[model samples]
Target chain A: MKRIFTPAFLLLTAQSFAQDIKPEMADSFRSSGKIYVVVCVAAIVLTGLLVYLITIDRKVSKLERDLKSLDKTSN
Target chain B: MNIKKNWWKAITCVLLFYTVIEGFLGAVPARDILNETIRNLYFHVPMWFGMMTLLFISVIYGIKHLHNGAMRSDLIAREAAHTGVIMGVLGLITGSLWARYTWGTWWTQDTKLNGAAITMLIYFAYFILRGSVEDEQKRARLSAVYSIFAFVMMIVFVMILPRMEDSLHPGNGGNPAFSKYDLDSKMRLVFYPAVLGWVLLGVWIMSVRIRIASISEALLNHSDTHPTS
Candidate 1:
């Protein structure tokens, strides 16, 4: 009984929390502080992508090594 | 090879150098009402122009795809659309912030704002439409048609609607744009470079994004043939 009530309470808490914030609140926030938010978000997103691009250079070297190993095994 | 390399690098560097100089000079006093937010105009306007330029390129690719039914054209169209969406979003955000500081409100329901929003929403819908469809060919074909329609609508809404109505936004009918208040040789120096810097930056970002998308596509295709356990 306690387990079932606990799960039900958690679900209700999640739904209630979700209902507390209106979509318009986010829109208002965006309108009010768009420049700062955009700059921050763009910097974060671009940094992540740039880092990913950089890692691909490493992956290419690994692939080259693997291919050389494969040729040696075949020989 | 040296010449070609230098040419691309030169074009990029010249633009960057100019933008840095202009951006620096822009910090100096403006003899107009625009104030500090006016500095954003140099960055913001060029982004909007770049967005328009990219959207036009997207339309060209869309038309070519329709004519040839080639996947490569579809890829180009998709890349251009993606880039346009980014620039458009940036333009809207910067414009809105500038408005809040200058007009004392984040939004005014002004004709230009409404038009810009509509234009962004139209392109946004293209992405949603593309996502909803499953067949690659059908998705490409339908999105191309929609993009062309959207491009036409965007021009009408942004360029025409503002002119037809009374707008607080400058550059509307009878409203003086940058030209009306003489660009002054000083501003022009910074203005041109800002345009080039921003446009080159947009292209650089877009190329990186496109390369990432292509790699993801290749990986997906590779996995499809060699099912992983």
Candidate 2:
């Protein structure tokens, strides 16, 4: 009985160890709070691109206005 | 820059800013084979959505051109297609990078990936078709017809075909979509807004391209009218 119990106990412990192996994630990075750095960098790049797009949009609007005036003057 | 006129652009900025911040910081289900890369859903999926939306707009403009024979409509269709292709290419590259780490291959013969590549090639051919034609009216008419065909083909390749067969991509084949498992309520908070933001950004870019095209067309006409100037 004692011998049988020992092996059963071993199997239970092995199963518990297996269950402990959870899927790995960036827990350490999050815990360290350095993930904000990445978030900030991405936000900055997106902001820059959006700003550039706005400038292009404004330039196009100006060009259209100028073209309209030019057409009026020529007519 | 007018708040009332460009409210959507403001929404685009706000939604994207929220997505960027929440996407990284948000809690996600830990699953094997995906792990942290699952966060890519917010970024990668939105590209495809944006492409689809832009392409749909392109086809609508193509139809408008066909009906009215308007050069402006043709220009809008062309520029929208151009922007859609850009978004599709970005989607492909980002998907490839994500696959490299998770799927263990940079390129696979998967149905979805191959379908996307084929769709992009078809659009590239659309541009070539336009370039090959020398006459303006002829080019507009021909490309408008071709854009309709191309848009249909895109739908087939990217949408229909992928679902008809087994694909490595989620939501295809026998595999369940991320929404069924990993894309929990938390991710949805970011995912839906990300889709909206990216689609808006694509439209903004397409609008800019269309404006630029209009300016060029106007300049050409002006030069033709006054050759000395």
| DockQ leader | 2
* Predictions in order: lDDT: 0.71, 0.88
**Which residue runs does candidate 1 get wrong by more than 4 Å?**
A1-75, B1-10, B26-29, B224-229
The residue ranges of model 2 lying beyond 4 angstroms of the native Cα positions read A1-19
lDDT of 1 by residue, B109-223 (tens): 8899999999999999999999999999999999999999999999998889999877889888667776644356666767777777677666655555565565566556655
- Here, model 2's chain A TM-score works out at 0.73
Q: Which stretch of 10 consecutive residues in model 2 chain B shows the poorest summed lDDT?
A: B174-183
TM-score of 2: 0.92
- DockQ of candidate 1 (2 decimals): 0.02
Per-residue lDDT over B1-229 for candidate 2, one digit per residue giving the tens place of the 0 to 100 score: 6788889988989998998988887767778999989989999999999999998999899899889998898899889999999999999999999999999999999989999999999999999999999998899899888888998998899888989998889988787777675448888888899899999999999998998998999999999998877
